[model samples]
Target: MKEKHEIGALILRVVLGLIFIGHGTQKFQGGIENIAGWFDSIGLPGFLAYIVASLEVVGGIALILGLATRVVGGLFVLLLLGAIIKVQLAVGFIGGYAYDLALLTISLFLLMNGSKLYSLDKLLFKAKNN
Candidate 1:
């Protein structure tokens, strides 16, 4: 049973990480200045574009590696929530929010549970039965 849960976590982490990496790479390909321009058009600080892009890229890697899962997940949840409030909500659930909502839920789950079996966190910080 525990192994099953661990496997589930691994699946979720990998899928979510891949999605983030794709999106992050897209942002980079589109150019940070262009992203910042879009952010400005949307009434957010232009500098946030770089910050968000960096978070997605680096956090995605951390998630895939199962390093600091809780921290990365929490950050991703916040990022997705911001996207929901600032953009996706206006598009409505069917149009945009469905995907964001799903990602947000998964991120929340990871944030609460952290990584399980095949995680660097586990290997690096294993408890000793002293």
Candidate 2:
């Protein structure tokens, strides 16, 4: 049923949001410069790493609060796509690529569907209607 699907999607959104927020928190603990340094060490553009880290942190918050869920999800999909192409694909599915792939799929789904019932988005919609 539609209700069941909505509940499942909400659970997925919360879990994914928490995981992203946790990783972002690690980055913030040492600040964006630290993350940028790590990216530079890997031969990546340091500024871009900061951008990705910011997106993960702020986007995770957006998702957790169900605010602008589609926009955040879409941004995350782009972020994950970059990760998959830049890092995971060459390494193959051996070292946790499966998990990343699953997350990417879920993010894409969220982008398409947006937050469901009981979310801030849903409440906003209802408030506007009423």
Candidate 3:
């Protein structure tokens, strides 16, 4: 296997997508209403639960497909930041912000790098470096 950053980006994109997909699916499986109530308890609007869940699932799919990579990355960054600030910060690094920070870093990478090669941006948009 060649050690190409494109391949690495692809792997990162897919894995991140899978993680978000699983989380989003879990939210639905556990009941959107319950998630909504939890969101309200956390000082966020209950409707946000549906939006977040939808973003996670839809954005994850978009990531895997290499579509709108930068856009999806930006959304992920915002979501992670919100999670860290609104909830995970209280739990401390061991079980909270650490993982979120990692995800945020990856999101930042995707935002900055724009999925590198092997992406829709490159294929369809004819992005020079993406």
Residue 118's lDDT within candidate 3 is 65
Better of 2 and 3 by TM-score: 3
Q: Which 10 residues in a row give candidate 2 its minimum summed lDDT?
A: 121-130
TM-score of each: 0.95, 0.88, 0.91
Per-residue lDDT of candidate 3, residues 1-130 (tens digit): 4448778888889889899998999999999999999999999999999999999999999999899988999999999999999999999999989999999988888888767456676677775544
lDDT measured at residue 5 in model 3 versus the true structure, 0 to 100: 76
Q: Compared with the true structure, what per-residue lDDT tens digits does model 1 show for residues 46-92?
A: 99998999899889888888989999999999999999999999999
Clashes found in each candidate (C-alpha, N, C closer than 3 A): 0, 0, 1
Q: What residue runs in model 1 are displaced by over 4 Å at the alpha carbon? A: 128-130
By lDDT, the better pick of 1 and 2 is 1
Q: List the candidate 3 regions with Cα displacement exceeding 4 Å.
A: 1-3, 127-130
lDDT of 1: 0.90
